[model samples]
Target: MQPIDPHSPGVMPSGLHASVVDQMGLAIGAGEWAAGSVMRIEELEERYGVSRSVIREVLRVLASMGMVESRRRVGVQVLPATEWNLYDRQVIRWRLASPGRVAQLRSLTELRTAVEPQAARLAALRAPVADASELMGLAGKLWAAGQDGDTELFLALDIQFHRLVLSSSGNEMFGKLNSLVAEVLTGRTHYSLMPEHPHDEALQLHVDVASAIQRRNPVDAHHSMLAIMERAMTEMSTLWDEAAHK
Candidate 1:
């Protein structure tokens, strides 16, 4: 998925409001405005060249996400990372764009590993026939994209494939995590963390998952999905290590 540009047309707050929110969110995530830092409305308005109303709106958005707390005399106090709504899409986007991106990726991947394999297994048992067929089609497209080195197409398809699996798992809670999966997949590609040409093993494992789900083989689906998560962890570790050494 594409990053939500503040200038772009959509559901997000437009123009200056969106820009201010994004900038402030990034700063908070980066620890530029550390927890306990107080941001006065007048100061923020002056800094961003916006009005009091705009600054208050931005603060409201941030406060809803647990990023800040507003008080009468103290202005807006930045909250600790522990207080932030980590699952909020905007929060996830900011964190991914921050300096601590690797840690965010690691945490997201671990969460996926814990949740998706069971989702795949449950999907094998409960997915509708049409959904299973669609997964199979997505898996094939993913293979072609990976083989052709089509990173953009691969990322989109990968997100769709995983999201479908989660939604088809007959569990609403798992379905809600689709956005989290999408953000992490997008972050990986955006940061050049993913290989340009995807691994053949990884491509085949996706196929294995779809095929097993289609065949109603829960065991195979579970194992194949687990393998995919394991492979991702190994790849990320290797890449992080290489980057660190350099």
Candidate 2:
């Protein structure tokens, strides 16, 4: 069977219920099916040229993501965007694909701002030597990439650097969020929200974070990471504002 294409504009994929799920997810994310909008099974079946069973399964997945609800008399109703599971990776991807994508990116960055500095502090006090060394190496490469105006390399290194910080925090909960952090990094680069040349101060803050972690200075690491995240929030919010008025 052909793999599902999310941008296919409602065309159902061949024999893949996942394709149906993606299409509906994109539609819901894009606001095509606004909150409280109800879709009947028969209508969906005819609309997508799919069987009731396929449509049912697809709707089940969407329901699990808190995107829709099925009632006894009422049909499948679209839930408010706030009801959707933003933490779910697939849901995050769907949101990133929508017109409200920059808003989603900003929201995720806010969450990162809250969590990552603490994770960096924990890593300073607890990460293994190998992880610390690797972080330092990545930080140096990030600096070079920034200086050379190598955006693609800088993006990859930046994601890896933050992912390592989260995973090396010695806190299970923090480690579990590595994927979410990865998505935000990828989203910024993919959407051109990142600056052509990363700021020198930003690059130095990354080095400071790595050095603090290496020296086991939790206080320094925490402050440095906080500065990094605060700068990121400002940069992304500026881009979001620009995009909104355009």
TM-score to true structure, per model = 0.93, 0.89
Q: Quantify all predictions' global Cα lDDT against the true fold.
A: 0.94, 0.90
Q: Candidate 1: list runs displaced more than 4 Å.
A: 1-14
Q: lDDT for model 2, on a 0 to 1 scale?
A: 0.90
lDDT of model 1 at residue 9?
A: 38
Error of 2 at 181 (Å): 1.1
> TM-score of predicted model 1?
0.93
Candidate 1 residue-wise lDDT, 146-211, digit = tens: 998888999999999999999999999999999999999999999988877889999999999999
Scored by lDDT, the top model is 1
Which lDDT tens digits does candidate 2 get at residues 46-115? Answer: 9777877789889999999999999878889999988988898889988898998888988898899899
